[model samples]
Target: MKLTREEITAALVGLLGADSVIVEPVRMDPYLREPRKRFHQPAAAIALPHDVPALQALARWANEHRVPLIPQGGNTGLVGGQVPLGENEVVVSLVRLDKVRALNAEAGHMTLEAGVVLETAQSLAADAGALFPLYLASQGSARIGGVLSSNAGGVQVLAYGNARELCLGVEAVLADGRLYQGLGSLRKDNTGYDLKDLLIGAEGTLGFITAATLKLFPMPQGHETALCSVNSPEAALALFYDMRRRAAGTLTAFEIIPAFGLDIQLRHRMLDRDPTAGPSPWYCLLEISRPAGGPEGTLMAALEAAFESGGVDDAVIAESLEERARMWAFREQMSECQSREGASIKHDVSVPIAAVPELIARGSEAAVNLLPGIRPCPFGHMGDGNIHFNFSQPVDADPKAFMAGAEPIHAAIYEIVVGLGGSVSAEHGIGQLKTGLLASVKDPVALQMMAAIKAALDPHGILNPGKLLPPSP
Candidate 1:
């Protein structure tokens, strides 16, 4: 038998007390709203547990009643994992559990509760003379648990690795309320089955991440930033190889932005001033971080060599911190600026690093062929082979009608991405948005393995139901 909304609320209030529960539909708006605003289904209730014990109790209660629980932190997920699908599900928010449990800068580790905001964690590390190295656009609102659950990748991935690599250990509350205390700061643990890796990118399906021990890095003295003009994606690829040879581990970011991206941003007046070297068909935002007491001008020398060899046409190096901020603002604002243009079809897809040029070339050609007037805005972390392949609707076209025509555009781009040995959902995990697509594209045996794991860890199907893994074939 299914529980009514009133009965569910009563049970939740009894377990968590009335103060920690929000049953009013109007009051749950913030928790229901996600960053992308794609999935906006209502949840039955929002439960804010104040501590670990309360969280465990709520998990156990949900498990017993067969109630679906969506684990949310900061409500900043680009995918809809933190938001709800069915009105019967309850959102378990970890915001009240924010805390910095411990820190050891010399030993390069820090323990933080799930609800602690990413920006706060970075500031805490900076105060202790270390760097967290996980930089994301939504860091101000995104939290540790959600970041780990999503296994987020940002600009510094080339040097620092993604969220999964940055994390040393995790403490989670499983579906049946059993606490898994796997928080160890050790670098090497050959212990059987890496549960931490499994939970990190599980998207809150296997367990509710409560807290984590994160690896920290020595704070960089400063970053060398530059905006370079590339004649083609081929040239960008060649320049990347040369820079990698020179900068090595010091290379932090190598983002590629198309001329169309700049045009959109400029049309929307998103940037105070143009940050590129000049008007070029494409631009590559390159950066390299130098540790304290390390030599400077490594990035400049590499760029000089590339320019002499005709790998780059021109470049502008950041002479000050303000200039550096401007260079990054141009890259980070790529997504938001698109909104002002019109309805846009977007994909966060990735391919092998070496195949990036071919992927972009072929993907753009297919998109153009699909919709003749569609404006392609392909840009992002070229160093990681992840491109935010987005297309803006025709100028002055009806957004509703343009969106209605996006089906073929999406199909064309995704087909090209897959054909080039790429993933449909790269940085963004499969939430409600891509569940069906994941099932179709994922390997059959791998899908079965995921299903088995989900059943074993969350037998009741109570944790973030209908996320990450697809149903059996």
Candidate 2:
């Protein structure tokens, strides 16, 4: 009952037109290339279904043939979930299905196809006089379906929530080609099982997402942005608490940046000019979203309070839109700036807000002890307790030699993170990058339950095979 490559291509051409099927390896290269370049296996063929019905048909045929299919969108996922794992798999690109089904700004919702780009979705909401509010550096290329599938969390997750919370409902095609039409703009629904939630973050193993109903919010009048100078991580934590008590929900983003970030930016000339208040051991980029008819200067007043109370050394509030953009630029370019420094080890982990200070302090000591003079750039989403704890390669050291010692560095930091009850992956999911770490860190009982669910949903192991769930012990 096995289908050869020729037969699989013939069946795909039968369901969809010949133009929709790609069998040549050279032509299918773009679909296989992911952002990370970590996964490089070639797919059997790349299938581009032009419509939802065709996609469902292909999925059903693939399921019956025991052929693996990887659902891909803009191909912008940092994790390798959007690319193929083996030559036996095929990638189904969702680009052609991009469309806006409906938009109701007053009702605060919109229905969109899975293939719509995140930036385009933001533009659509802006045109309707509302805000989608899920902003990421990859928004220009990241698709709605991939965003929801990964349950991505961006900077503003401190206020709004992640992609899962923003999605109201999803319509997906199951493994057997049955359409699960669950799209709606309902604010409250006491539904059974919460199937929509299950499929949102399933990474296409359970089903192929076709469309979704997403939540929107009223446009903020403006934002109060500031760059603060702190002597240490403990001071940054105290400043965050002061800002939270003062602004509450309006305190949308509180990101930490180390002094090395600015050094790299300056050395690489990544910024047009200096954006910080001055020099300090640490910097915190704080933001407050001002609602309609709300008072301004709340962020400035809170910074002044922190300054007087010795929580912050100095601060620079953005006086113009250009300055605000520059401050954000410094924070957003932290990851890219590290690449310029040479080889680096990165971990996106989160602990309790109260434990963040300890996580940073203990983690820094461990990495420093393991490798002397290893620059630690521990920053990001301090309000969410998610720090992108990355270590820059030691100065004047060989990149290969530095990377070879990454294991001990990772082990040391993860030990501190686990001891503090933190998650190894704060935003990025368990793609091919973190499968080994997941096996070691995840609860045994939870892993068993996940295996059972994966077995039931993908009985043939054809959908995104060898992902998320580790192999049974």
Candidate 3:
């Protein structure tokens, strides 16, 4: 027998103190709404567990009563993974669990609770004379738990790695209130099946990531940043090859941006001035990190070679730290600048590095054929093959109408992505938005395997129901 809403609230208040349970609808608003504003559903109550024991008790009670629980971090997830799906579920906000358990900077690792803000973690590493290379726009609010759950990838993924690669291990609470104490700082743990990797990208479907031990690196002495003009994506790719061949591991970031990106940033006054050298069809923002005793002018030497080979026409290397910041502002503001234009159809897809130019050409043509005058803004980590393919509505077009007819555009881009042996959803995991798409494209055997894993861990189907995995036929 299912409990009524009032009964559920009372039961929660009984378990945790009345102060920890929020029954007011207004107070529950923040936990229900996500970044994309796509998924909106009421939650029974917001449960605030102050410590691991409290969270474990809540999970055990939830399992017994079959109450669906949505584990949320700082509530900054792009997908609906961190929000509630229906009125029957309860959102477990982990903000109060913020704590720094251990920090061995010299040893290159630190253990932090799930609620520790990502930016705070970065500051902690810096204070210890080390570096945490995972940098994201949402790092100001995104927590370590959701970061690991989604396996987030940001600008530095080209050199360091994604959230999964940066994490050494995780400590989680299972569905039945048992603890999976897997946190460690070991560089080598050739043990049995790697449960750490399995839970890191599970998106809260497997368990609630309570804490984690993350990897750190030595701080770079300095950085070499530049924005270069490339005639086309092919030229950018050639330049990237030359840079990688020359700089090797020092080539930290290689981002590509179309001319339109710069235009809108300037038009909206998002930037004080144009950061590129001059107007060109495309631009590549490349950066190389200089070690403590490393030589400088590596980027300059590579650009000279690139210019002679006709891969680059013009370029502007940052002469000061302020110039470097402006160069990055141009790239980081790409997504925000598009919203000022109008409604945009976006696809976070990725293909092979060599096929990026082809992906952009074919995708732009396909979108234009379907909806003429559609502005395509394809830019992102070109070095890692993940392009944030987005299309803005035509001038003076109705936002609602444009969004209503977005099906064909989405279909066209995903089809091209799949045809080129690319992932339909890159970086961002298949939160409720792409479950159906994942079902259509994912291998059947792989889906079955995922289902088996879900059943083995969460038999009651209470941990983030109707997420990550597709519905049963």
Candidate 2 lDDT for residue 40: 83
Write the residue-wise lDDT of candidate 2 on 1-473 in tens digits.
76777787888889999999898878999899987567788777899888899998998889988999999988887668889888778899888889899999999999999999999999999899899999888999989988888888999999999999999999998888989999977888986788888887778888889899999999999999999999988888888888999999999999999999999999999999999989998999999999999999999789888878999898899999999999999999999999999988889899998899899889999999999989998999999999999999989989889999999999998889999999998887877777788899999898887888878877888888877777657
Residue 380 lDDT in candidate 2: 90
Off-target runs (Cα >4 Å) in candidate 1 are none
Query: What are the per-residue Cα lDDT tens digits for candidate 3 across 47-133?
Result: 999999999999999999999999999888777888888888999999988999999988999999999999999999999989999
Quote model 1's TM-score.
Answer: 0.98
Alpha-carbon deviation at 266 in model 3, angstroms: 0.6
TM-score, ranked from best to worst: 3, 1, 2
TM-score of each: 0.98, 0.97, 0.99
Error of 3 at 147 (Å): 0.3
- Residue 212 displacement (Å), model 1: 0.4
| Per-residue lDDT of model 1, residues 328-356, tens digit only | 99999998998889889898999888888
lDDT winner among the candidates?
Answer: 3
Shift of residue 381 alpha carbon in model 3, Å:
0.6
lDDT of each: 0.90, 0.89, 0.93
Error of 2 at 446 (Å): 1.4
